[model samples]
Target: MTASHNWPPIDPADGWALILTELQRDLERIDPDLVMGQVKQKFGTLSVSAEASDPALADAVHGRIAAAEALSARICERCGQPGRIRQRPDGWYQALCNRHALEAASEMEGES
Candidate 1:
């Protein structure tokens, strides 16, 4: 994905691999010459930046991004199992399943 004008540094996390792969494929179909920018997780959900020439194409690209984000919100950031957004004592948030939530909490406690 990066080779396209050296734009996309697409590094999908363990849980987001499948979602991102489908996203990439959909993006290519929408705009074959699309050049992607930084893809990050914002507010415990997927956030993506992409370049498009036509407004119509851009709108379609945005729709796909939104769809991917929606799907990711229900999945654990560490594993693909169903999850929800959790707030850390420090105010940080993440999408995590019940099993991984314990591990994350332990790590946070260690930091404290």
Candidate 2:
């Protein structure tokens, strides 16, 4: 199969964007005719939908998705930098760089 040009639009500011791009390239290598159906981000996780002619190609795409998801957990949402996932007292979760994480903590403390 040949890779189709139906890749979903992505926000460049998102740290995980690069990972998605790499996945697209890898998918092209695996099957150039593969159809990328949809891509979306929700609750700090990325979802990619793809269709391939063969089971092996589909599995490869799934593997790529898993790797990208793992990488997103360590990338800051606010800035494209190394980070850790943090949860607010209100139960909201975000991945942020150290600087942003500290700032968020300070803000939460001030709310008290």
1-112: candidate 1 lDDT, tens digit per residue:
3324544544556787778778887888788777777777888877778886567688898898889999888988788889988887678788889988888889889999
TM-score for all models, in order of appearance: 0.86, 0.72
Q: In candidate 2, which residue pairs clash?
A: 1-33, 2-32, 2-33, 3-32, 3-33
How high is the CA lDDT of each candidate model? 0.79, 0.76
Count: clashes, candidate 1: 0
The local lDDT score (0 to 100) that residue 45 gets in candidate 1 is 79
Compared with the true structure, model 2 gives a TM-score of 0.72
Model 2, 66-87: lDDT tens digits are: 7877787788877768987878
